[model samples]
Target: MGLTAEKRSADWLAQGGLRPTRQRLALAGLLVGDGEDRHVTAEGLFAAASDAGEKVSLATVYNTLRAFCEAGLMSEVVVDGSKSYFDTRMDDHPHFFWEDSATLTDAPKDELKITGLPMAPDGTEIAKVDVVIRLRRK
Candidate 1:
């Protein structure tokens, strides 16, 4: 990786109050080095790390992803209960889950509209709303 990209990776981790470990730097580089938003699963990230000769274990990848989520570096979007996707874009936006190819992409925020939501119970208040529209090719 180029020096600029490496620095960016390190800086990102640092900004999130996470130590820039060797493995984290590598994974961060893969996730955000290109300056593009994407969604990835633990298995997929492990495979990519292996393909890139990262020498990281699948368990490590899972742990790293969880850490990233906890640190607010990424958001975990759970689909179908069993499967989850980690997204690099940190914003209040909806997503489109392509059922045919099992891919997740951002949905246009302007097009999605919600009229009413049930009031929170007791002293609680609404935290956030997640919208995932599933799509399939006809």
Candidate 2:
């Protein structure tokens, strides 16, 4: 069963037309091998790799994450411009950002809305809009 789940995730990446290399497969296993989604950064992923006893370079983690995002296996959320968090959920949903804890959570899709459309910049188009709602401790 464990091997089957891992293979399913690897195959999912393969179905996206991405080469499931060892590093990519290893990262994918950490990201979605379990039945739950998670928010992680490349640095966090590197830590996870260490915890799992997997040897992966930071550059490789970033590269594989970019590839996964491009292949639709993950979503990139830029809570802070300098740093970005990755989400394993591949659906159109907003995010709940806990500033104090530095965590990202899925917001109910129905609680979001968009109005007053703005014109697109020259030679650019809107692909997807990610809304991040921040929360604080009382």
Candidate 3:
């Protein structure tokens, strides 16, 4: 990664109240260093880290992802009960899941319209709505 990207990653972690540890910096560089959003699974990130010569275990990747989500740096989009994708974009938006390829991408917000939603049960209010549109080729 370029020096500027590395500096941006460090700043981002600090803004999220996360320390810029070596592993965190490495992973952050991969995620947002390019100034482009990304959707990545834990396995995918682990592979990328391995290819980048970072000595991080799959469990560490998972834990780091969880921490990122907790810190509001990333959002977890669960496509199914078995798998989830971490999104670098924190905005409230829907996503499109390619079933065949097991990949996720942002759906067009302008094309989506949520007219109504059912009332939540007592003692709880709606936090956020996550829409995942699954797609598959014929």
Candidate 4:
């Protein structure tokens, strides 16, 4: 896409309260218009930026992702506690992660339903729930 397209996307994001800096805009453009979903870690996003000719440091990517999450432009997925993966989809849904390839894909909502949990601890209720169904080639 051209700079105009980039600027337009930035404008849409800015309307959502995100200050789309150049790096942020570049990252935004990458995360969208690809015809597929994305699940990128900080390192993954950094490499992608470089490949896309977007000059950005790893730290900058990390910070920008945090800002994007805060601005509601992206969703942070933490399937593992050690590292977090950024997801662009904001809708409520589940995921299917391929363990062999470490690829994350969306799981159709109708395919599953989780309910009837025992209960939360005293004085605590469900804050947020994430379900990632892992898969491997059999």
Candidate 5:
């Protein structure tokens, strides 16, 4: 038999080393209940919560998302100085940002290659590199 929504949420949270608080469970239900990968912004998630009759604040959404990222539950994609998206898939991959539609979609990671990356600062070590290819309609 398939896992119930509550059980699935709890298990997912536990896998990420997070306690499944009521708020977290509610948000997680909305984020991953369908079992499909997605990219969402804080504002978008808050709106979704409201649409789903979840009484969660925007600040809470942001905080929860950050916590989830820290717990390795999701990955953050920074499109620019002002825009960020949280990706449900945690594996290293590239994304395409559609400028006109303000949407993000995955790029085939196996098809991408990075070369000639500059060295990090003297005391700093390089972490994972994220690639976001921005596109616009012709």
Candidate 6:
């Protein structure tokens, strides 16, 4: 038989080296239950939890998202100084941020390329680079 959503979420969390607490299970189930990749912010996820009858606070959502990112289960995309999005798809890719709608969408990875990047600092190593193409109505 197939595993239930809760069970699957619990297993995933365990594999990610995270303890499967009640709040974690609930939030993880909501985030990854459908097996579809998604990008969401803390406020957006909190609204979703509220709509789904899950009693999760915004602060809890933020903390949980940070934990998930630290566990390598999700990726954080910062669009602006004040706005950040959590992406479920961890593979290397780019994103399109719609300014008017404040939405994020995946860009075609094969079509994007980076060149002419400056050298890293004397003692620092270059980490992964993220590209976010911003869009607005014409």
lDDT of model 6, residue 133? 97
Q: Show pairs that collide, candidate 6.
A: none
* lDDT minimum window of 10 residues, candidate 4: 1-10
Spell out the clash pairs found in candidate 4.
Answer: none
Task: Name the better of 2 and 4 by lDDT.
Answer: 2
TM-score for candidate 5, please give it: 0.94
Candidates' TM-scores? Answer: 0.95, 0.88, 0.96, 0.86, 0.94, 0.93
Q: What is the C-alpha lDDT of each candidate?
A: 0.92, 0.86, 0.92, 0.80, 0.91, 0.90
Report the lDDT tens digits of candidate 2 across residue range 4-119: 65786777788678987888878888887775798998999999998999999999999889988898888899977877999988888999999898888888899778875688
Candidate 1 on 45-135: residue-level lDDT in tens? 9999899999899999999999999999999999998899999999989999999889999999999889999989999999888899999
User: lDDT score of model 4?
Assistant: 0.80
Better of 1 and 5 by TM-score: 1
Off by over 4 Å in 2: 1-3, 121-124
Number of backbone-clashing residue pairs for each candidate, in the order shown:
0, 0, 0, 0, 0, 0
Per-residue C-alpha lDDT of model 4 across residues 43-126, encoded as one tens digit per residue: 998998899888899999999889888887778878667668888888888988888988788899888888777689999998
Question: After superposition on all CA atoms, what RMSD does each candidate show versus the true structure?
Answer: 1.9, 2.1, 1.8, 2.7, 1.2, 1.4
| Worst 10-residue lDDT window, candidate 2 | 1-10
Query: How far in Å is the alpha carbon of 66 misplaced in model 2?
Result: 0.8
Question: Least lDDT summed over 10 consecutive residues: which range in candidate 1?
Answer: 1-10
Alpha-carbon error at 3 in model 5, in Å? 3.2
Per-residue alpha-carbon lDDT of candidate 3 for residues 1-138, written as tens digits (9 for 90 to 100): 345889879977887999999999999999988888999999999999999999999999999999999998999998777798999999889999998899999999889999999999999999999999999999
